[model samples]
Target: MKMTRIFVAALAALGLSGIAWASTAGQREAEHFHWHNAGPFGTFDREAVQRGLQIYQEVCSSCHSLDLIHFRNLGEAGGPFESAEFPNANDNAIVMQIAAGYMIEDGPDDAGDMFERPGVPSDAFPSPFANPQQARGSNGGALPPDLSLIIKARHHGQDYVHSLLLGFNEEVPADVHVAPGKHYNPYFPGGVIAMAPPLFEGSVTYADGTEATMEQMSEDIVTFLTWASDPHMEARKQMGVMVLLYLFIFAILVYIAYRQIWAKVKH
Candidate 1:
């Protein structure tokens, strides 16, 4: 059939493309992100997420932005944003800063200016770049992609990122030619991405009294990134339940309808 031929052609195309990526992506499974205890890996850890957010604010925010993520998402990780503002610099000064652009004032009137300055709310996280060009220039023209949805894009994302951070540099075969400013990594979309390893051994200090080893820090950051990308995990789960319930109900109705229509016309 025509449809069968089309399906075969599509499969062939997919195979060729995947092969091309394999040559370029050169990504390995062991050294890149492979979390032993995260949602996709094992289970979600609320405490690890909380710590990851703290680390993100202090360190990674300088380089990355969770523009699609809102300030309120912190609630899922046991941080309900105690105050009305974000990244609050002080107890009294409410104008919280972000890696992205400054927060534009927007809220209900008669709320009576709770803080000295306006804040970024849970509905939004600002973009650091004025535009895409500026963003590319800032990061050696690599164009730091918005990380708010990175977890969804990455393969075994949490694990891959964690592994990369834990010094999972790749071995370029002696015959392969690697251009300058490009690092060979098996975990990147292109086996040779411009992104150098971001995390290193003992790169951060933990307030939870945990050792700031490469493994711990990488895992923590990945957790935060995952939550940032998918803040509504609980909501999504709820919706899934509703969907399943609706399907069950619909099936029952259809069965009843079928029985009634055929009952009077017994063959």
Candidate 2:
């Protein structure tokens, strides 16, 4: 009886907690947008990914860190900077140039002194802040989440991120009480977000002459992030297609063999 009561109490507590979470987090649904890489055969748009990378470097890198990515990854198969001539990403001239642009801290020298040097292709993208405390200090006590795997981390991630970027409302609703630092974003949990609207018209001039509209920027960034999160998506999809084709052929052969053998025997 005591065990049953304990379990019942636990269930009730969990139910209440779920209800509370729903009250806070379930306010709005993210609007779905068409993504180039949505279906099994869909592939990342190279131009969009490249544009997204530029946006990240110019704007988002100041706050968020892409710890999982290395400069060399940019030149790998299916990456935005990938080239047919350069199979080895480390040797890719474009990747090397991009890496050299960053100042990376190197190991202690023979004199036991740490020093900064030009980054190499193998080096990971540097964090904007030295530590978590510094990150929070810079962003009004809110730590900017690392965006490396954000797409996989969040539910309805692509839609959620796209929506969040454009969700900020200039006019606050009367029913909503937004704190000083927080901005009104109905799409965000609790209808408020610490981060302000990051994108605006003409935020970054596109190299390929694409117009720098907010929606275009958002879509581009999301595409880039999706690629960042799943670099092998295209390869995986291709492999899946091959596997399905192989299985289909094998099944047909097996059926033919079975029919051939059964022909000699009475059903």
Candidate 3:
């Protein structure tokens, strides 16, 4: 009973550091933010969102909450991920699957008696505690934030996520309190955040045998957050491509028109 209580207390403490704290990605060191320089999947695989999603589920999701997103949106992030398995994800179903970890009450809705989480699209995932005060009292006053649009709302978008994931460093003083865990960065929008550095060098062992270095993991996770920030990435990419195609066609027509108009003149 004692051990069970301790474990429960620990989780409750972690939960107390409720979601709401966020650090801007671009706010980190200039070099690290270069993850943006990696370019799109064509330039560098931004599609690692699956990999990043895996990282978020394995590490960050336990404490943070993406209350705004539904489990079904993962696979739909890009045109479907090519592989059947993501390193951290058991099956391709990771996208549509909900976290089975904690369950809380969400009050009555259309279903009448109330619903359970990770609830279907029809339900909202319940918080670990009834309210923020409960969370803060246990968590040393930290609150996690909704991660749905973090990438978009912040500057440099995806680049920022990449930098922040790998940027946690205790030696930097800003992150001293996090020790082996969370850290602080002067660049984070709020100037301080409760999240510890969840990813570290060789922290996770991938099933497919990729190096588990911090940089790789950071890149992967940022990709996922980028997608989560905008579930319609594929739609945006398609729109960009169409716009470029239209501009190219328009340019050709304009050139033709110019030649016709200038045909009678010679220099």
TM agreement with the true structure for every prediction? 0.63, 0.88, 0.62
Q: Candidate 1 vs. truth: CA RMSD?
A: 8.9
Candidate 3 residue-wise lDDT, 1-267, digit = tens:
864564444433322222444544435443445543232222225446556666776777666667776544443434235334553232335433553444646669876887655434233334454566766665667876667788766665565566666555634554334344345765565445666667878776665577878888887777666666665644544555555556568779999999999997988
Clashes of 1: 14
Worst 10 residues of 1 by lDDT: 15-24
Q: Model 2 Cα displacement at 41 (Å)?
A: 0.9
On TM-score, the leading prediction is 2
Winning candidate number (lDDT): 2
Model 1 local distance difference test score: 0.59
Q: Write the per-residue lDDT of candidate 1 for residues 74-143, one digit (tens) a residue.
A: 5333232334443442331222343123444454457765332345434465566768888788877788
lDDT of 1 at 142: 81
- Whole-model lDDT, candidate 3? 0.57
lDDT of 2 by residue, 77-174 (tens): 98999998899999999899989999998879999999999998999999999999999999999999999999977767788899889888546779
| Candidate 1 Cα errors over 4 Å, as ranges | 1-25, 29-44, 76-131, 177-181, 256-267
lDDT sort, best first? 2, 1, 3
